[model samples]
Target: MTAFSAIHEEHESDKEDFTPGVEPQPTWCPGCGDFAVLKALKGAMPELGRSPEEVMLVTGIGCSGKLSSYFESYGYHSIHGRALPVARASKLANPGLEVIAAGGDGDGYGIGGNHFMHTARENHDMTYIVFNNEIFGLTKGQTSPTSPKGHKSKTQPSGSAKDPVRPLTLSLASGASYIARTAATNPRQAQEIIAEAVEHDGFAHVDFLTQCPTWNKDAKEYVPYTDVQDEYDFDRTDRREAADMMYEAETKLHEGEVLTGRFYRDEQRPSYGQEKRSTGEMPEDHLAERYFEDDPEFERVADHLIDRHK
Candidate 1:
């Protein structure tokens, strides 16, 4: 493993550049919304001029976890609900690497909820995409955190007594610099939002509504949606305004109305890495490359110096 260095050759690339050859077709079921996420993500990378080598995708265990295998990039299919920690470390190790963490709602908003809050609060420079399918699709449709109140599943056969989580609002409250919601139903919108999220400087959260058609039959395909930017006019940079807007969107979503698009953006705040660098806490030389001679060329130089001194 190349201990997560970011320097790479920039070149022309396309969506096909990210697709793996000789890999099995994605196992997502017919009409599965996970396809939209893959498509949008593939499209976003090309448009952002990022090559597969320049990106690091970290994913947690779930149907979404398989995404790392399909996308031809530096990837890690970590254990359940632990993608964020792995991704945060990778980004800190290689600040220039475009890091994207992905997982299902249960894996992210439920099991890894604590990591999610702290990561957002610290404003790590990376993108976290939550596949909000409303239920655990790969695990036989068990009721999940975002599942509507009264949503019945194998775990909650009669009906779920818990209310769904307000993910977007929670992202805001946790101090995420950029927050948005996009559905797999709208591929173009999903692509645009993902591209923007990838470019954002701080913790960018996209609560993606990817429907599990095979398991979650009740979730609205997330269409007939409203883009907060285009339909509901408001200043995206305003914190209080963004909070109010997120609250409304979260409330309406469970009521069967799909609200998608950018909710909050704060370009002024520095990312965690940037803050450390500004405060002189970050060393001038990358620790992995300098102290450890992790770079091949650096190892050669050290070996030559030792021989000369002998």
Candidate 2:
């Protein structure tokens, strides 16, 4: 069978399919919120009927970056804050691959902020999950972009005077077609949100509130989080309503009131890949399939190069 077809072969899949046999154990600290993301992803894969081979898990440098090692899939451990770009390229090359990028607040919202904004603006077909613990967990509790104003950390000893980045609002402003927030303390909701994000055909951003118990001592475990869909009556499909609701949720998070759920979705818009293909800029065939399939143009180029070298 061809490489592309082989990986996309139909089969009965379970959560175990996403677990690496050689490295099944994760070294994350006990009570670490990163573990919840791993669980939610593994759980969501089975529900989506997506085998590990059909998925690409890209992660950036951070405690959350270890996800690539634990999950059995086409994994890429990119440099700090570069996960989104890598994921975007992979999805563009192989539109069939289910691409998911993951990183911490520092890696994504801070260092990778530019890429994140543009990718959403273009509406790339992929899922991005940011582990927002308010502080940089991997770098020993430094003040992150999402850190609350006046929040003191080792890096911000005098308490940070800058306000935190509102991720949901920023996502909406950047034109992300799908946006949501979920907490590590609520695995069921996290899994559900992940499944929905994966099913989305455009840019899907999930601001996952993961408490870093080891570094963030003052941050709560994100418990008592209310699902906005269950508690509030807001039209998630309406941009104005979603914006207002997201603003309220962002404000509430700092005030110790946690609101979690799908905040926005726009299904009418097309994904980046769709736009490119519609414009005849991107090919319908998967780029990786070139090696498995014969093409006269590719052969002509190869032969010309070989003759010149010889």
Candidate 3:
């Protein structure tokens, strides 16, 4: 197993434990779906038996990025569309930390879109929470990548002609080991889904359909939803079946029928860290803990360059 911190002492952790000591109180506009995500995440942490010290939350720029501040865990407020890369580095350095990367749809699926696809492709052992509000909430509601076709906005006053990105399908095609869609409207399912994603060993992507009443007034409130696992017959482990279900869900999203639940999971696949360790590439101990080691590769390389300059 990957050793995160040798000195990290385990203790009983509760929901309140994840509440930051000194940070902004969740300032999302009233009725903003971001509240539900925070709540579900808070609830999921205690369920995982994880302490704030054991978890790390990395977020990108945007309203959703505020999660790092509100969360009590070790946090990183990375730049716009860059939470994933920062999170990836942290996880690679210390895999024992429960790494969670969160960002708004625009921050995640727009400029950071390339990072999202590749992170999933590598099957990184981390939970990625994309607040799919379908628009950029912080930037005054512009037409985001996930905005439906013909969607009107300050950026697209004539209604956007660009087709919305099918995040779940894109996630699947990118090779995420676990993929699911949840919404702020369904807290119970959201909590359960988040918890499951945390427990999953490989890349877990949760497309959270959050509402933005302050903006995107035309966006669906994501109410009266149906959980595919509870109501539909599909194999989560079967790629073809999962793909079919995701297609329907992505289609019905625009048609006003909200479908949410686990769409795909492949537990058989090994996580990036695991693969590296198995191949003798990843050191037994975390790289972060070796900074003081004598003649570490980095120091050796620096010494080589210095001698050449001399």
lDDT against the true structure, per candidate, is 0.90, 0.93, 0.92
Task: Tell how far residue 269 is off in model 3, in angstroms.
Answer: 0.6
TM-score versus the correct structure, for each prediction? 0.91, 0.95, 0.93
Q: Which residue runs does candidate 3 get wrong by more than 4 Å?
A: 1-10, 292-301, 304-310
Candidate 2 structure quality by residue, lDDT tens digits, 124-170: 99999999999888778899999999999898899999999999999
> Candidate 2: TM-score?
0.95
What does candidate 1's lDDT look like per residue over 73-148, in tens digits?
9899999989999999888877878999999999999999999999999999999999999999888889999999
**Greater-lDDT candidate between 1 and 3:** 3
Runs with alpha carbons beyond 4 Å of true place in candidate 1: 1-8, 291-310
Best-fitting candidate, scored by lDDT = 2
Among all windows of ten consecutive residues in candidate 1, which has the lowest summed lDDT?
A: 1-10
RMSD of 1: 5.1
Better of 1 and 3 by TM-score: 3
Candidate 2 ranges with C-alpha deviation above 4 Å: 294-310
lDDT for each residue of candidate 3 in 1-310, tens digit (9 for 90 to 100): 2234533566678998888778747888999999999999999998988888788899999999999899998899999999999999899888878999999999988999999999999999999999998998998989999999999899999999999999999999999999999999999999999999999999999999999998888775898899998889999999999999999999999999899999999999999999999999878777776765655555466788999999
Structural RMSD, model 2: 3.0
